[model samples]
Target: MEAERLRVRKDNSLLRKREPIPFTRESNYSTPVRPPDNDELPGEKKGLPWPVLLFLVTLVVPWILPIGPLRLSAYRIVLVVMVLPCLFMWLTGKVGRIRLTDIVVLSFCVWVFLSLIMVNGLSSSIEPSGIMFIETFGSYLLARCYIRGPDDFYNTVRALFLTNLFLFPFSLIEFVLGYNILHDMFSAILPTFNYPPMAARLGLSRVQSVFDHPILFGIFTGSTLALVHLVLGHGDNIARRFTRTAIVGTLAMMSLSGGPIQALAAQVFIIAWDSALKFLKSRWQIFLSLLALATIATEILAKRSLLEIMIATFTFDPLSYWFRRLIWSYGWASVLNHPFFGVGLERWERPDWMPPSIDNIWLYYAVHHGLPAAGLLLLAVAFAIWAACSAKALDSRLCAYRMGFIATLMAFFLTGWTVHYWGAAHCLFLFLMGSGAWMLERKANTGIELKTDTIKRIPSSHQRPSPHRNAFTRRILSETKLQISRKELPVLNPKGKVADLLP
Candidate 1:
């Protein structure tokens, strides 16, 4: 009777112990199932996401299509294709959390919509306003959804880099031949739109390449230089990185646009600052103090606004300075007069002698959309910069890239004071903003998840013991006392007899 009772107890304990072993194994295995790092996940196909691929198509299509009479550019066509996908993503919850940056962007769009209606009236403005909203805010949301992680961001950069590489030869030809073959070919097929006279500087023709103007080409190439650097910075292979860097740098110089050169300089400066600040104990405080001092010194020394100084420094044209001064003076007056809702999109009533073009982008927005709209736009940019700088949880290299993006943006904004960017270049601004916001949100969420996991891993004193604790303890003690491996232990069968687990 005693032997039977002992056998029954042993069988019960073994069965209980077996159950907990599987559970412990499962927990141990699953504990390592972490969120993906900056690598392609298993079974994930390595390719650009659909929306990103579509965005790249948009960038290339503009160069291929003839400048049509109806303003049906390639950008419009691709944006139309993007609409359904973006809407579906939003409805299906594929689009991630709505963030503050998103809210600001949307608000800016709404303000632009209202400005158009107020200035142009509801009936006349609906179509153009819709197009603008779709082109700007819609594009931004698409980027935000598609560029969810580092892989997507790098893919986008690669796409841009490839596009630039393809165009580099054409750009060089245009400069050397002092003529644009692509534009000429397209113009033959479609009604030739009026373009500015090709300007010459330093014995070279200012080449527009595949773009509408030299300034646009310069800005595009310059901004891309920063992105190329970002990609090359993270590369493990030194030879590959050096080769790519050389190619991109050579292409950037070939464009010979002051705007891009300024942008490239700005990126280099920001990168150096980032590197230097890392060594400082109070980096943020020191950086801010330096920034303030620099701003004050610039104001005192220049005696003109920093915008004017930047414009003067980048341009060799004697008339460029006077022209920008006149535009700013007239543009500011118009903005103040129509401070709430801008004067209708109609040409500002100025003395016939005054220049029509408001070269400054901020002034352009203010003059057309009112101060409120411009303010929201600036605020959105501010939010993007803040997000980039504050993203502490991102990979260090990615954080550096984000800072480089911010620098690129700042350079563009500064350049906008001298040159007007429309079409694809303007879209690039929204892309950067959306990308920055997405990265910031992703890093923050990952950090939060890690913290939650850490907290969950900590044992609580109030936790109850498992129901099978005594059985588990007995089984473990028996195995230890017997000095046997788990394979040597007896397994319980339906008939309550010891069975060999191993063959």
Candidate 2:
């Protein structure tokens, strides 16, 4: 017995630590055989695409670079430089099937040229119209071409968070010091326009960071709050998600701009509504019904327009609300006079002392470009949101992405009513709309079928029992890089077979 015990210890090695040899597939098929990670999947073989990274970096960088008489903005330069390649990709159907957004956006660009030509003759028109096209179509093209899938979409959300994370400290410093160090530093180095100290709002200096204006900075950073909080951190740790979101929200707040704060409020309201009544299946319909009732109640009780109340109540101050009311009243008049093709960049006649800057984006486009341009732009934004919502998600992560995408776009949509986006902000908005349109294209893809042996051969330890509706099936679909739907997964995993195959 002693001899046998010694032999067992020596040979079988009960006391010895054994290293686990991971399972490997015998088949030569290139399919990855691993369970899905909670956040990122196992099958992403490539790095984040370059076009996305380039544009995003360009976006946050300081805007103007003075060379001779012309002021060349970095975002526009990047957009213009990439136009040809993106256009070629579009022509080749590399950006997926062209949809209504694409058609309307392109048409809007054409109308801008027509309006400019009609007003400012073709010679002067070329420069302005061409720049507008580069800003609009170029940015859209890049997103359409490169941001093709859920992974790409999430990467974008992650990038936005990181970029803003980098900006967080600078924004705080700007607010506390009552000076924009980066803006001043960049001006010294580049011989750009030296902006005077902006007036304090809410007893703190408005933080512009590297953006052209504080409002722009706020809106741009606010754009990422919903996306980073909900989408990128969907399957991540709860504490970490809130921390990240708080950082982003604080960064946005440095600007003290009501437009972006309103945008953030809109997202929070939507998120709160969604969370509070998540148990109910038709929560959205109920919310809409409630909103309609509230609107009707306000209209009857307040003896004022809902629009007026919303604008006045949501602003940082009453004066801002009043100014915006004046803007709308006159901007609408300008639109009415030149309905089809509005005055092309010509100053719309207002009171002599009123500010020349148009604060509203929809009104800006309608007043300068035309109502058709504004209508098309509005249509494009609506379609982008709807397509993302309507397209099915492959898994929880993707569902979170759809949620974030909608929220971010909604923020932009709401923000546009009070603030005009130019330079980087404008491009980012168009790029986002273009990026989410791929979800519509995704719906057209047919699901791939996996042979039953693929699952059967996977060892029981590696396979988790997922029942009829399986997260594992979604994982498998992702692992194989296929677009297989949840409905068809039950065919392979029968009620009895799943347990029988386990051992």
Candidate 3:
């Protein structure tokens, strides 16, 4: 008996690759992306995505080499290599239409360059700013390019889960021993940053595993908990979901950081809230409204600002929260002083007793670069989240997937207030945020209908090609007076005729 081969009748956006069946073009012709030869490439590209590659590089290879004023890390090396291709993908519209977030991120990069140049000499600042460009925009674009849809998002989350699962035992051993074997082993043979081991809190020592710090290790592993349960957990047995969650959560707890705990608590709270209010379609809106109202109420009623109160409430240590409050006050004051271009790498003026380290990533950008630079980055994130929230998913799977991505991001938004992400964690955060780019483009309906041969035509892929590569698609859309998707589309039925491809 022969095995039955399943063929996809209609194209799905979630399908990793649905190469447009080639059509004859009387005008400028274009080729498909990386045309498969010798039948090696099949339904989907099986290798890890570039973003996952970055993720793995961060986890596996923390090798750092001192380069002049900066220390080079493995993930940054990957970004430096990937930035050009990433830019090419964005410009060619391979990912999707450019959203406000895309424009904001680009503007943020330029703003960072200008801020750096103003504070330091152009020669001195250009390299660091360019490095920032690679770290922020490059990582963002890489996620956008590879994680195209819900399926990719699920796979990415699965990869994270499995990786964390593998690291679980090691993290446990590291916690018990008060030493990170992986970090110790890596530092032995490779160039690694020296971070003194954190003090043991509550009889257990911090477990950093392979990352630079305990908080980093904790947050990186913990943030994926929501992504796992919400995306990959759907339609699966509760046992499996619990197992995966337990693995990730326990590993995160091994680091024994308050930020991870708070993030996990937030994830659980959202999950429970959704479960309780699943009947209401407007539940999320209600939650957001209440949250907003609470913020205003807190601002008016509480002695501390809402941010300060939230940080204090969420933090495990009251002392840490107080320290951060001081940082916030002093930090914003300095940001006000250098409102245009900030103090650059140079330390901001403060009372001699206050430690030099800025714990908040949001505040770090403002203090080190400028308020505008930080604002642009914040706006970009907000826009990305809003884009995801506003768009309609084509299916329930996509809906759940969006929830997972958003939940993880929410965790990061809160976690970032207490701890500043640096090195691999920083790159990972941007990459994860950028992975939601596809959500920005998805819609429940294309609003396209086909009645007969005279029906409108739209591109299947989301690439809005240039004149030469996709001239045929452009001409067809122009003639038919139809909207185009993000991918490059072709006129399947030339001579003003198209078979019904839309449902």
Q: Please, what is the TM-score per model?
A: 0.77, 0.82, 0.78
Query: Highest TM-score among the candidates is held by which one?
Result: 2
Candidate 3 lDDT by residue in tens digits, 223-307? 8888989877977899998898888888888877788887898888888888799899999899989999988888888855677
Give the 10-residue window scoring lowest on summed lDDT in candidate 2. Answer: 20-29
User: What is the number of residue pairs that collide in model 3?
Assistant: 7
Q: Which stretches of candidate 1 lie over 4 Å from their true place?
A: 1-30, 40-45, 63-70, 185-195, 237-239, 249-255, 443-503
Ranking by lDDT: 2, 3, 1
Ranking by TM-score: 2, 3, 1
lDDT of 2 by residue, 54-89 (tens): 888878767587656557787777787789998898
What is the alpha-carbon lDDT for the whole of candidate 2? 0.75
lDDT of 1 by residue, 138-157 (tens): 77777887877777777777
Could you tell me the lDDT of residue 59 within candidate 3? 55
Clashes of each: 0, 0, 7
- Which RMSD values do the candidates have, in order? 10.2, 7.2, 11.2
Candidate 2's clash total is: 0
Alpha-carbon error at 133 in model 2, in Å? 0.9
Candidates 1 and 3 compared by lDDT, better number: 3
